[model samples]
Target: MSDIPAPELAIATRNLSKQFDRLLAVDNVDLEVADGEVYGLIGPNGAGKTTLMRMLAAIEDPTTGDIYLQGERLDPDRPNPRLKRYLGYLPDDFPLYDDLTVWDYLDYFARLYDLREPGRSRRLLEILDLVQLIPKRDSLIATLSRGMKQRLSLGRTILHEPVLLLLDEPVSGLDPIARQQFREIIQVVREAGMTVLISSHILSDLAQLCSSIGIMELGCLVESTSIQELYQRLSQQRLQISLLGDNLAKSLDRAIAELRNCPQVESWTVGDRQLTVHFNGNETDSANLLRQLIQAQVNLYQFQIETDDLEDIFLQLGHQQTS
Candidate 1:
C-alpha cells in the first residue's frame, strides 16, 4: 500500500542561512507559514528581516538550506518556473516602466505572466479596480503619485493571482490614508485565500492584519507564533480604574485598601482621580475584584482592561538589536 503524503504548508524553510563575506545576513533558521495565513515579519533596521525575505522570494540565493513551497522543494540555483508562477513578490523598490500608462503597464506584466487576449484584458480591468487605479488607467506611470505608484505596483504583483504574496515595506512612505487603503487591499487579498508574508516597521498595522508574526534579529528568527498566543503568553493585563465623587481623596483611599486585599492586583498607582493597576488574573478574577471594590463603596466610574499591544510586546522582548 502506498503511504499518504503529508499535508503541505504554504511555506517552509530548513536551516536557511545567507552569508555575505564576514556578515551572516541570515543565520540557520527554520520557518513555516501555513496556507491562507497573513504572517508579519518585524525587527529593527539591521535585524536581517529583508535578507530573510529576499531569500524566500528567490531574489537572493541562500548560502545553505532548503525551501519548500506548497510541499514542492524549490532550488533558487535552478530555474523553477512552476513554483515561481505561484509567487507574487513586491520588493521595496519595484521597478516600473515610466514610459507606460497605467493600463499599458499592467498589460505588459499580464503578457509576461502568459495571460492572453480577452481574459488578460478582463483581469487587467479587475486589477485596476482592486488597486483603485481605474480612473488613472490612462495616466502615465511617471505622472502618478508615490502612493498611487505603490498601489499600481501591488496590482502588478497580484496580476497573476499568486497563492503566495510577499511584500517588503510596502507601506513605508505612504501617508495614513494611503496606508489604510493599502491595508484594506491586503485584507481583500487575504480573504481571497492568498497567503501573505509582509514586513514593515508599522507595528500597529501588523497587529491588526496578521494572524501570526515572526520576529527576526541578528540574522536569526528569534520568535514566531500566532498573534493571540503571543499576547496571551507575554502580555500583562492592566486595569484603569477611575473614581467619581465629590470626595475623590476618600474614594482613592478606599480603592487602594480594596486593591491591597485583592491577590490578583500585582501593583497599582494613584493619580488625580484614577488608579492604574497591574493585574495578573483571568476574567473571573477581574469580576470578583470589581465586586469587592463595589462592595467597599469605592465610587468606581470606570474599570477597563488595557492589554499590551504588539509594540509593547516587541519592546518587552528586548530583541530589537541585531547584536
Candidate 2:
C-alpha cells in the first residue's frame, strides 16, 4: 500500500534470508528503516525476530542477500571494524556489571569504545543526565531497581554514540511509570538523531512511539505501514442511534425491522430506546441511515459513532493472513 519512494534509508536489507539446517528461519525479507525513525517490528513467538536481529548485529550470517548500514554494504565475513562504532544491540535481557557503580559501569563501556580525554567524560555525563541517572552515578548496579538497571543498560548502549540502535523488547518488564520513563529516553535518543529497530509484543507502546511498523508472520513481512496511514486505513466504526418518546419497545422493533435488510449495517443490537448498529460504512452512509429513519418517523435523540481500537486492526490483519 506504500507508494512512497525511499531515497534515504539508514538500514536497508535486500532479499535477506537465514536458515538453520533444513529449517527456514527468515524468508526473503526486505526492509528500509529511515534515518532517525523508530521502526517497530512485531509478531508472535518464533517469527524470526531474533534471527533477523542477530543478522543485523553481525552475530549471525544471512544465507543470501545484502544488509546495508547507513547505505554502506556490510560483509559479515569481513565485518568492517568501524561498523561496531555505528551500531548498538540491546537484547531483551540486558546485562549490567552488578559490582560496578553506575559511573564506573558507564566509564568501562566508554573506554571500550575508545571515548578518551575530556570528550569521554562529557559524553558519559550527558548519557547519565539523559537516562536520569545522574544522581545514581555513585550507586552500585546491584542496588538499583529493575527500571533503573534498564535505563543504565540503555545508557551503555549509546555510550559509544552509535548511529543505529537495535532493541528487542526494551521495556518488557517495566511498570507503567517505568515504561513511560523508558519511552522518554527513546524520545530523547531520537531527538539526538538516532535510528532504531525495536521489536516488541507491547503493541500499545509501539503504537505510541513508532513512526512506522513491520508485521512479520511465518518469517515473511506481511505488512509495512506508517502509523498515520495505518490508523486511516483501518479506522472502522459503529453507530448507536437512540430514540425519543414513549413506547420504546415498539420504536426498537420498527427501527430493527426497517434496518434488518440494510447492507450498510453488518449487525445490530436493539434495546428499548436504542439501536446499536455495527456499521462498516462511512459518514455518508450514516447520514443516509439517519435521514431514512427520520423520514420513517422514528424519532431519535443521539447518533454516536465509535471507532475500533488498534488491537482490533492488529488482530484482523493476522487473521486475514492466516485465513
Candidate 3:
C-alpha cells in the first residue's frame, strides 16, 4: 500500500497470491473488474474460488500483491473500517437468526454496521420493499421459505448501499423458479449501478447473470472473457425450428435435405418435428433462407435463433485445454 495515486480501475489486483504451508492456493494473478459490471468467477472443486473470494473481501491476506478498490489502497493488514460502507460480502453458508423477525434482523445489522437514526429505519423499509419482504417484515425468520430467506439475506447485504457485492453461490439449493427469481433480483441490483463479483459452479446460471466470466484451474485464472465474445470463440450460431401441419415427417425430410445443401447451414438434426441447425451466416442469408422456405410452402410454426449455452462453452474450453 502506498500514498501514490493508484489506477482508477473499479477493482484491480496486481499479481495476487496466497500460500498455505507447501501449497499455493492462489497463484500470481492480475485481475480487473470494471465498474458496474457483473463478473463471475468459475472453477472446479479445488480451484481456490473460496480462497480468492476471502482475499478480495479482506477476510484473509494475500501472501503477496496489492488490491485497489476505486483507485484506493485496500490494505489487508490494516483494512479501513469505512471500507464496510463500500463493500458487502455474502458467504456460501451465511447463518440466520430464526428467532428474529425480518425488521428486527435488519435493524440489528444496521446498528452493528454503525448506521444512524431515522435513516436506518427508512433504509430498513426500503430494503424490505426491494426484497419483496414488506409483507414478511412482521413474520418470524423461521416461518419463511428458503427463497424468501435468500432474498432477506440479500437485503441484509444491501442495507448500507455498498458499491460492490461479493456473493458466493447465492442460489445454491434453490429450485428452478427460485433461481429465476434470484436472477431477477440480481438484475435489479445491477441496474441500480452496483458492481458485483459472484462465484458459482453452475455455468448456466452464471451465463444468465454475468457480463463476463473468469475460469480458474490449478489455482490460476486460465481465461477471462465477455459472454458474447466467449460464445463467438467457442461455437457458431444455432437455429431451432418447430414445424407445424400434417405430413410433418415428410415436411421435415424435405426441409432437412434442402437445408443440408444450403451453404449457410453447416449441419442440421431433425427429431420430434423440430430442426436444429448449426449456422454461421449473416442476417441477409438467414432472411433469404426463411424466404425460400415460405416460397416452398413449408408450414412454419416457430423459428428462433438459439443462443449459445454456457455448458457447451465450458466443455469446449476443457477440450481446448487438453488439446
Candidate 4:
C-alpha cells in the first residue's frame, strides 16, 4: 500500500489569552490544527469562541500568548502581507455590495487581491463553482436569499486561494437544505487540503464534520479531543428497558432484581416502569442482559442502550464549568 502523506501543521496557538477591560474574553488556550483538517470550536453564547478565532486570524491581538502559522510566529502588531495571501476569514455577519452583481462583487475582491487579468477571471469562475453560486453570477446581490448571500461571502473569502479558512457561524441562519449544502462545500474544501476552523453552537454539524473539536465555556476550553476519543470516553453502557404493565413499579423492581443477580450485570435502577442496567462489560455484555430479561419472562416492550450523544456531553461539560 502507498504511504499516506502526513498532514502539515497549519495553525497553532500557545497560551493564547484575551481580555476585555477586567473581563477575560478568552482564557489561556492552546490549539493545533493540521492542514486539510476540519477543527470545530463549539460553545454556548458568550463562551469566547469568536474572540479566539479573531485572534488566530490576526484581526485582533491577544492580551497574552502567541500564534503561529505554518511554523512561523504571527506578528500581530506588524501584520504580514504574505500571511493574508493564504488566509481567508468569514465572519458571522457577511457584508455585501447591494448594487453589485454576484460576479462583479467577486471580481472587485479579486482585483483587490492583485490577480492579473487572466488569473482574475480564472479564480472568480473557480470560486463561484466551488461555492455553487455560478447560476447566480449575473444576479444582483440584493435579490439573493440568506443562504445565497452566505455562499457569495464564502466565494469572496476564497477568491485568492487561501490555504487556511477561519469561518464563524457559517450556517447560523441557513435553512436545513442550505445548511446541508454549506456542509458539502466545506467537505469539498477539506478534500482539497484546506484547513478549516469553524465555530458554531450546532453540535450535530460539528459531530458530523469535525475530526477534532474543542468545547469552550466561560472563556476557557474545557474539552479538546478527537471524535472517536470522545465517543469512547463518554460511552454509556447502561441499558434502558421499558415494560408494558398496569403495575409498572412492580415490574420495574422485578426487572432490577433479575439484572442485579446476573454475574455480568454491575448494577440496576428502577424508574417508573423503566429498568436501567449498567453492565460490568462493554456492548458484548448487553446481549447477556437481554437474554436474562427474556428468560425471566419480563414483559419487555422496548430494550435499548442509552448512548450519550455530542449534545449530552457538551451540556455536561458546560454545566461542570459553570458550577
Which has the greatest lDDT?
1
Model 2 clashing residue pairs (backbone) = none
Candidate 1 vs candidate 4, TM-score winner = 1
lDDT per residue, candidate 1, 286-320, as tens digits?
99989998999989889999999999998888643
Clash number for candidate 3: 0
**What is the per-residue lDDT of model 2 for residues 28-97, given as tens digits with 9 covering 90 to 100?**
8888899899999998898888889888988889999788888777898785989767899998876788
TM-score of each: 0.92, 0.86, 0.84, 0.90
Of 2 and 4, which scores higher on lDDT?
A: 2
Q: What would you estimate as the lDDT of candidate 2?
A: 0.86
lDDT of 1 at 285: 94
> Which clashing pairs does model 4 show?
none
Q: For model 3, name the residue pairs that clash.
A: none
Residue 293 Cα positional deviation in candidate 2, in Å, after optimal superposition: 7.0
- Report every candidate's CA lDDT: 0.90, 0.86, 0.85, 0.84
For candidate 1, the per-residue lDDT at 127 reads: 95
For candidate 3, write residues 224-260 as lDDT tens digits.
8887788778755888878999888777766776696
Counted clashes in each candidate structure: 0, 0, 0, 0
In model 4, the runs with Cα more than 4 Å from the true position are 1-7, 245-251, 262-272, 276-280
Residues 51-156 of candidate 4 have per-residue lDDT tens digits of 9989988888999988888767788788799986778999998688989999999988998999998878988999889888889999999999999899889889
Which segments of model 1 are wrong by more than 4 Å? Answer: 1-6, 244-246, 319-323
Question: How far off is residue 318 in model 1, in Å?
Answer: 1.9
Q: What is the C-alpha RMSD of each candidate to the true structure, in Å?
A: 3.1, 3.5, 3.7, 4.1
